[model samples]
Target: MKNHYCVIMSGGIGSRFWPASRSSYPKQFLDFFGTGRSLIQQTFDRIKKIVPVENIFVVTNQRYNELTLEQLPELKPEQILLEPCRRNTAPCIAYAAHHIHAINPNASMVVAPSDHLILKEDEFLNSLSNGLDFVSKHDVLLTLGIKPNRPETGYGYIQASHQSLDGFTKVKAFTEKPNLELAKVFLESGDFYW
Candidate 1:
């Protein structure tokens, strides 16, 4: 099978992270996990193992181009995509997808946040491989949805379908950030998370 590609989106302001994530230094460049490596560097290295280093792209704002390059030296300057303005995730992703498709039409791209915490390396890679394999054979949008843990009102949630085949859960609907009560119900129901 052809190798998959990964796009690390690090242009976010990270308002929730607060004072720790300043305008000069965003959360993606912070060592949130205390793993010695910054989030952006960790993300770049993690995807490198699965995808060719050249195939991995870092999409960010024009201002942070130098910071992204300094953190991820493995990535070429050209590989770091820069956005002229901040619109939203959808537009950023759409622009990136189109740019990448123009270069490699067969590429299977995985869009991931630069600040997420992944404890299980093997499991994460396995899931990614599955997504790539699925995308290669079928024309579908692949997303890795995590299960919810507690009644947390911070993150959004995705509802998975009843059908379960080949260890992949189907997505039903995506729920925006909910109130504490609704979040508690979601957690107790044991449906999904992100």
Candidate 2:
């Protein structure tokens, strides 16, 4: 099997989080819940189970390089790709992809958000395994979307298709967070969760 690689997207400044999440110290580096381990530290521990320490890469802004290093001392310098400016996800993924692709032509990678909260560990792991398995043989972009639990205006919704591949559902369409009434209907339907 080809080595499964993961590129964690940890470059966001998280403006909504406000006072706690500053540009200098983003949420991923903060231990908001007093878990002793910061969010980024927790992420590394979780992903290491499936991907090797060497195969997992972290891409962040040049400014946060030292902070990331301070937190994740196990990582070598090459494993962290530091960007000079905030070019957004596309450029960051592109740069990392090109480098990884050059090193391993048959590489299959998963790009994930660093600050997501998943309640069900088993379900999340199953979905992750399914995604990694599917991507190994398929040349397609894959992202795992959570169901909208409430009609909150904060997040987007994924409309899943009936089709299932290795227990993974395909996203038929996406719905923006609706108003109170619409969100109520979604909750009543029990089809989505946030």
Candidate 3:
């Protein structure tokens, strides 16, 4: 797994979860489920199962540096790439990719949010390992998605073919937060994942 890397994106203001999550203390640092570990810690645990601890990097806002270190003491100080400012996901990812490339030129990375809660962690890890393997040998970008239980406006949706292709389906298009009407239609179609 030396060639594998994981990038955790934890810089979002988490405005959607406002009133509870503010700029100084975002949702990723909170333990909403009272699990002792914060959301980002949980994410790190999950990713570390597949990727080596040293190979995992966190790309968060510079402000969260102390909080991140306090929570995840297992990581080296260099593992955290604090952004001077929040420029959104694309730039955050690019920044992480650039830094990680300097360390491992032929690395394959799995980029994920720091607030996700997975119930079936073993299954999720298995799927992630498979995706990492698939991407390592092919010059392609593969997205791992969850089967949405609800039409959540907070996430992007992937539209795929109904026909399964070797346990995978072809992606038709990506839909931004669709209205309730479109979301219901997508649910009925049985091919949209968030």
Candidate 4:
């Protein structure tokens, strides 16, 4: 997996989960589940199984640089991509992508949020492996979508076509946070995943 890389986006202020998660210390730096590991730390551990620890980059705000370093001390200065300002995920990803491409032009990256909780780690790893394999041979942007078990308006949804090739489906469109009624339709149609 020499060409594989992981980018963990950890710059959000996480205002929704306030009090427990504040601007001084976002949710990504906290061990909210009593797991002994912060959300970013857990994400690093999980992704390292597929990509080398050295190849994993954490993109966070300049304000949280110390927090990230404190949580994951093993990270080198270069591995921590400090954002001068919060421009959201796209720019954060572009920064990392440019850096990674400069280092390894053949790099295939898996960009993930730092504050996600994965209960089925083995399955998640398997899916990641499959995604990596798929991208290695194709020039396409791939994203892992979870079949919504509930009408979770908190997350975005991907509408995929019925076509499935090598366990990967063709993404038709992306819809962000549909209302409860539309969410139910998406769930009932079995065509959407968040």
Candidate 5:
């Protein structure tokens, strides 16, 4: 826990899931599953098992600062990295990574979305542990890819190379929101994952 850091990205407006999710109060602040805890709270809870409470950070827009605070009251103000404007997940992650690296150069961080559902807790943690272990000893950027159970056109696809190291395949390419036909081909290839 000393060197482990978790960054939860919670700046999305969730326009697709509107009505239940709005700009003022995004989906991360709502319990979409009616599980008592909001999405951000659930994400924080899961990551806290592996990361210390103080080491966890939330990256959100300045507008959503109050919402983030309301959802995650345990976090200090500094733990919440507020972006001046919405620049998507890449910039948010980069900001969090820079902040964490400045504090602890040896830190290995996990950047995750605030609104995601993980039903298999044990498996998820085990995979995360494996990835962390792999990265600790190697100079590489590791990303966990989920094997597609269906032709999911909504999510981007990662094409894996033939080589495998520490149970992780090299990402050959990334395809974004492919058409239905291309999605079917990816599913049948047995090499792509969402």
Candidate 6:
């Protein structure tokens, strides 16, 4: 449906990536694995299958406006929202939400980062379809997550209720990058998702 929209967040400078990812050209714009398509382009190709090209928007820093166009020429200049300064994720999401909501009052949006690499396309898209359907029907905030499948300390973990309402678990608490011991505790409890 035209009411379905996607907002791709691509404003980060990606300093952690260092040599490969510079301020001028961050990781999102680089073809990390020789995929021909850059990370952001890969992200766009996946989302465009579900959301209309016109309905999809990219939120990036003002400096990357031209770079975004160079990479995603299908999107009109207006579809790219440029931030004069970096205000991080919350503000960036709010900015995109305000614009999308104003254009279509009934718009259902999926806000995603530009750097995530998902290997299973069919499964991811299927889950995305379900999440979008669930969000469109109710006035609620929804996010996709997978149960901890590996030992990792860098991911943020969400503790969800044992019960499920309408096929969605209620998030009880969130722990961002817990220590190794805490991560093990979550892995054992079996109620946390990363």
What total of clashing residue pairs does each candidate reach?
0, 6, 0, 0, 0, 0
What is the alpha-carbon RMSD of candidate 1 to the true structure? 1.7
Instruction: Report the C-alpha lDDT of model 4 over 72-188, residue by residue, as the tens digit.
Output: 888898899998788998999999999999999999999999999999999999999989999999998899998999887777999999887887899999999988888889999
Q: What is the lDDT of every predicted structure here?
A: 0.84, 0.79, 0.89, 0.92, 0.89, 0.91
Candidate 6, after superposition: displacement of residue 117 in Å?
A: 0.8
Taking all chains together, each candidate's TM-score versus the true structure is 0.92, 0.84, 0.91, 0.96, 0.96, 0.96
Instruction: Show pairs that collide, candidate 6.
Output: none
The predictions' CA RMSDs to the true structure, in order, are: 1.7, 2.6, 1.8, 1.2, 1.1, 1.2
Worst 10 residues of 2 by lDDT: 147-156
lDDT for residue 81 in candidate 1, whole number 0-100? 89
Q: For model 1, state the Cα shift of residue 187 in Å.
A: 2.0
Off by over 4 Å in 2: 175-194
Per lDDT, what order, best first? 4, 6, 5, 3, 1, 2
Return whichever of 1 and 6 wins on TM-score. Answer: 6
lDDT of 6 by residue, 109-191 (tens): 99989999989987998888788888889888887888898757999999998777699988888898999999999999998
| Segments of candidate 3 deviating more than 4 angstroms | 162-166
Residue 186, candidate 5: Cα error in Å is 0.6
What digit string (tens of lDDT, one per residue) describes model 5 on residues 123-143? 998888787778877888888
TM-score of 4: 0.96
Residue range 18-88, candidate 1, lDDT tens digits: 89998788899999877899988888878877888888888899889999999988889989889888887
Expressed as tens digits, the lDDT of each residue in 30-116 for candidate 2 is 887888988888888787777788898889988888888899888888888887688887899998899889889888887867776
Give, for candidate 3, the lowest lDDT window spanning 10 residues.
161-170
What is candidate 6's CA lDDT for residue 66? 97
